[model samples]
Structure formats: structure tokens, C-alpha cells
Target: MDFNENFVLGCSAIGAGLAVIAGIGPGVGQGIAAGHGAAAVGRNPGARSEIMSTMLLGQAVAETTGLYGLLVAMLLLFVKPLVG
Candidate 1:
């Protein structure tokens, strides 16, 4: 369309790319949490239920970051707020 529109679209694409990077943190965090949880359960088999529940909860919380990143990327690509 116009120069400003083109610039906004380009910037939005870059920003969306950056936003998707947020998924990395949650992936790492969840992996570490799962590893630690498994270790903890191995150390104390009797506490397996507690460890599992806590690990699942923590993983769910950590997953929100990735979900947020996806949402942001979707909005940036589809909404085109700045371009408008």
C-alpha cells in the first residue's frame, strides 16, 4: 500500500518473530521442572502423587508463556493494529 503501511507490516513481522522466541523459555523451564520432579520422585517413591501434581501444575503454569507468545504472534500477524 503506502510506505507507512509497508513499514508497519515489516516491523510487525519482526516483532512477531521476537515474540515467538518467548516459547523457548517455557520449553526449557518445563523440561527442567520435569527432570527435577522425576528425580524427586525417584528419591522418594512414597511422595510420587504429590510430586506429580506439583510438577503438572508447574508445567501448566510454565506453558502459559508459550501460549501467550503464540497469541501475540497471531495478533501481530492477523490484527495488523499498527498498519491500520
Candidate 2:
């Protein structure tokens, strides 16, 4: 490939790497949320519905960050925004 093409690919790879880094926050947050949810369930099994609903809602919201990261990575890898 040409020097410019190689440079763009390298930059895209770096951008994808940086984009994927965003997933860490959602991952850690989801894990903490899940742990707390499990603990809440253990403490009060009767409120399972409420606890589950709230946990799922929070997890889904938190997961958006990871989704955005994945989207950015995918765009970098596949969409080839820097190609043109």
C-alpha cells in the first residue's frame, strides 16, 4: 500500500484501540451493579421483581457506553471513514 494508506490504517487502528477503551467503564460499572443487585436479592428475596427491574434498567443504561465504543470501533474498522 501507499504511505498515506498505511498511515491512515495505522491511525484507524489506534482510534479503534482508543474507542474500545471506552468499554471499560461500562464493564466495570455493570459488574458492580450486578454485584449489588445480587446482594440486594440475597437480602430481600421477596422484592425480586423490583430489584431485577431496577438492575436491568440501570445495566441497560450503563451498557450504552460499551455499545458506543463498539460502534466507534466498528466504524473505524469497517466503515473506513479515513479512506476517502
Candidate 3:
């Protein structure tokens, strides 16, 4: 391959790495949310169902960030938009 092709591939790899870093935020967020939810349930066992539902919903929402990051990384690594 030529220098330009190599450069594009290298940049794409770097971009995919950066994109994957986005997953960290969602993981931390979900952990914190789960911890708080557990604490909330412990404080009020009568509300366990409510707390669990809310926690699960929030976790599902938070998970989207990681999913988006994965999608971007896959696209960057496999699609190679800059190559063609």
C-alpha cells in the first residue's frame, strides 16, 4: 500500500480506539446507578419493585452510549470511509 493508504488506516485505527473510549462513561454511569438503586431498595424494601424498574430503565438508557461507541468503532474499523 502507498503512504496515503497507510496513513488513513492508522488514523482510522486511532479514531476507533477513541470511539471505544466512549463506552467507559456508560459503564461508570450504570455502576453508579445500580449502586444507588441498591441503596434505595435497602432503605425502603417496600419499594423494591419501583426502584428496580427505574434502575433497569436507567441502565437500559445508559447502555445506549456504549452501544453507539461500539457501532462507531465497528464502522471506523471495517467501513474504512476514508480509504475509498
User: Which candidate leads the pack in TM-score?
Assistant: 2
Tens digits of per-residue lDDT for model 3, 5-67: 888999999999999999899999999999999999999999999999999999999999899
Tell me which residue pairs clash in candidate 2: none
Give lDDT: candidate 2, residue 60.
100
From the highest TM-score down, the ranking of the candidates is 2, 3, 1
Question: In model 1, what lDDT does residue 36 have?
Answer: 99
TM-score of 2: 0.88
Q: Write the per-residue lDDT of candidate 2 for residues 1-84, one digit (tens) a residue.
A: 545787898899899999999989998999999999999999999999999999999999999989999999999999888976
lDDT of 2: 0.94
Clashing residue pairs found in predicted model 1? none
lDDT of 1 by residue, 1-84 (tens): 457778889999999999999999999999999999999999999999999999999999999989999899999999987787
Candidate 2 RMSD computed on C-alpha atoms after optimal superposition onto the true structure: 2.4
RMSD of 3: 2.3
Error of 2 at 63 (Å): 0.8
Local accuracy by lDDT, each model? 0.94, 0.94, 0.94
How many clashes does each candidate structure show, in the order listed?
Answer: 0, 0, 0
